[model samples]
Target: MNLTLHVNSEQETLDLAALLATLLEPKDVLLLEGNLGAGKTTFTKGIAKGLGIETVIKSPTYTLIREYTKGKLPLYHMDVYRLEDVGGDDLGFDEYIYGNGVSVIEWATFIQDELPDSYLTIKLEPTGEFFEGRNITFEPTGEHYEQLVEKFQKQASEEGLI
Candidate 1:
């Protein structure tokens, strides 16, 4: 299924992340897609917050991946922006993607072939006010993801996060 959201500000986006967080469970993979300044990382910060992570969230542009726990579950945030290598074995993708935690990967397009069969992908774009507004669309790949989206949608409606 597909869902779209128009965020008027950064806070709105964060609220959306919080809403989405309620739907996520351990061992789930979230593929975030967007251009620079599209608020991919910003949205992640909100998700981490809703996940109950205490540390500040920042884009792992250079670090490749950042792990945030202390929330409902462990969050494995990854950014493969600079990855020029693609080895089915060395990537150890299953370690995190299939591990006992929630995985959020930025620039996941780089390793599209490495992604699991089931995942949640969000594509973000600037609608207006440049960096002030964002249009994010989510796509669910399986029953698991569909349930996640439905749960988020229902909770968002009840919480007015939508």
Candidate 2:
């Protein structure tokens, strides 16, 4: 299933992500696609917040993967942009992707071949109306992710967030 949501400000984006975070489970994989300044990390920060993570969230661009285990479930944040040139075959990503936590990958296309069979892909784009405005689309590749999106849409609507 696919779902799209519009947010007029940064806070709205964070709120929406936090809402979705509450519905996630272990082994849930979220692929974030966007331009350089599309707020991918910001959305991740919200997910960390909802997951009860207390430390600051930073982009894993250089480090590749940053694991936050203090949250309700460990959050494996990965930035695979660098893999475009080097490849990702030796990263052992499966350990985290199928681990007892949620995995959020930025620039996932670089590691397309390494991805699992199912996941939720989130695309973020600038609305061009305001600096912080964004149009977020959720695309699910499996029944579990489909249900996750459904619950997220329903909860977001009930909370007047979408």
Q: Kindly list the per-residue Cα lDDT of model 1 for residues 78-103, writing each as its tens digit.
A: 98888756533467877888888889
Tell me the number of clashing residue pairs for each predicted model: 0, 0
Off by over 4 Å in 2: none
Worst 10 residues of 2 by lDDT: 126-135
Question: For residues 1-162, what per-residue lDDT tens digits would candidate 2 score against the true structure?
Answer: 799888888899889988889999999999999999899999999999889898999999999999999989999999999999877898899999989999999999888888999999999999875555898999999989999999999999999997
lDDT score at residue 13, model 1, on the 0-100 scale: 90
Candidate 1 clash pair list: none
TM per model?
A: 0.93, 0.97
- How many clashing residue pairs, candidate 2? 0
Best by lDDT: 2
